[model samples]
Target: MPINSFISLFGRSPIGPMQQHIAKAHECAANLVPFFEAVMAEDWVKVEQVQQEMARLEREADKLKKSVRLSLPKSLFLPVARTDLLELLSVQDKVANRAKDIAGLMLGRQMAIPQTLHAPMRAYVQRTVDASAQALKAMNELDELLEAGFGGREAALVERLVEELEDIEHDTDVMQIGVRQQLFKLEKDLAPVDVMFLYKIIEWIGDVADRAERVGNRLEQLLAR
Candidate 1:
């Protein structure tokens, strides 16, 4: 059977509004990778380029939402599909925005990655990015799983992903505290503004992880129904 037909036989339609939202969310996730990579490399020029790409992706996602709304029947989109799509778009955008905020913080401060904390902090950002991307993938497929009335594995999978994210979040917290302590011990003269900016960037990155974990929780709830 043809690919489309195969999916149709499983009681799913390929031309779903949710699918478009999922694609847009994945685009955000893809954009985040480059942003994290640039930060890790301390490639300031490439960081600006990543920020520009994220802005473009946001515009694309907005256009997609408009197109989807035009095709969908307002009545069919109720508490489930409509709300889920909106939440997905919002969460995806937050990921990109948080990444952009981190880059903006770096640019504004003209701060270079400190040698002592460089490796651990870079690893932390990269891991968080990976978790966010995985969360997006799981969320994007949730509608299909829900519609198919698939086994309990849907919730199980989401739980596992969220658990992994939680683990990473703890590690980030530990690393942040350790780095801050190291900074204070080595240089008591560091600018307050610089410290504030670092805190904001770290908070924003943590927010992205929190949002991704929330998305997983929402998917798990939808799967249970």
Candidate 2:
């Protein structure tokens, strides 16, 4: 909740501040590591700990996002159009938003990950977090892009990072399919409602990666401009 990153979301060139914001957003996604562990262990206490922390992080991201909306168009020297910068910020924020959503829904339902799902589900959650991590890595290059005037070597480097993020997201897709297949095999043993929510959880986990890749896509658009 402390979110020291809020100081720079668009302070000057919009690069440094955006970097900070994504770092915070990615923090929410990264928390899923411990969260899934707690869930698999059926440790509701630990689950709540991670969930509360994520809520704090999401709140911080939301505050910074609102700040960006309120503080723009004054003295900030945005290299890209104001709308483009805001779009990137919005995408980055969704990473945290979805992470929070996954935790909230899972906790509220006291959702249990089937024993058969434990392994693939853990891998799935980690891979999704990895995607968000990659998104943050690409955003970290924004300052360098600004230095190079959004051209030359720095822009290329960011493009490579985005490409890697895409690959991670693709891998996530494959994993989701495999996990669903496993779930289908176990569904007859599970309650109909539980099976439905399990599928939804799987989908929401993938949403984390999907939204993370969208951040990279948004940045690519900025680079094109």
Candidate 3:
């Protein structure tokens, strides 16, 4: 099948459903840092805006999925661009949802991050977001790589993204431990439920990085094929 014909059949294009979702994923990943920073700093207005934007993007992604399902030719798309795009979008969308999930946890628990804990957590999340952005950027170059049908730079870049995400994940674990240690020391003033909520949000946020890493892995697999 001609590439254009395949794309029309499956709703795939240079700036089609997959590209749109991936782009939003990068934006969400980047914005999450400031979203949490706003929470820690007690900036309610910014938090509300970022949270809304995150929710809006996620909803739009879902709509796109439904559009693909109802409008595209399924048999023609299996194991091709449509399937690849769907998988990529699903993974990317998870990051945004996770960010929103963390925000919801903050609201539900009225948990503001400790001042001393802010710096390390902020740095870790920023790194994770950057890694996810890089992963998405790599995805943008995928078509070019496939067209060239040649070099190993794209593969190498994907490997580097995975490594960077691993480092980010490790840093998140360390920060989580440090934050818990400090919280433990001051546990007399805080309720156990609040502490658990805090930990839960942290874990979800960490999963955003994990999802981003998985995106890099998927891109690697697709490019290799």
Top TM-score model: 2
Would you estimate the TM-scores of all the predictions?
0.74, 0.92, 0.80
Model 1: which ten-residue window has the lowest total lDDT? 71-80
Q: Which pairs clash inside model 3?
A: none
User: For model 3, how does the per-residue alpha-carbon lDDT over 64-175 read when each residue is reduced to its tens digit?
Assistant: 6566556555554333465765676677778767766776666555577777778777876776676677667666766555444424775566566666666766766676
Q: Using alpha carbons, what is the TM-score of model 3?
A: 0.80
In angstroms, give how far residue 42 of model 3 lies from its true place: 1.8
TM-score of the candidate numbered 1? 0.74
lDDT of 1: 0.61
Best-matching candidate per lDDT: 2
How displaced is residue 81 in candidate 1, in Å? 4.9
Clashing pairs in 2: 8-17, 9-17
lDDT (Cα, tens digit) per residue for candidate 2, span 100-191: 99999989999998898899999999999999999999988877676677889888899999999999999999999999999999999999
Ranking by lDDT: 2, 3, 1
Better of 2 and 3 by TM-score: 2
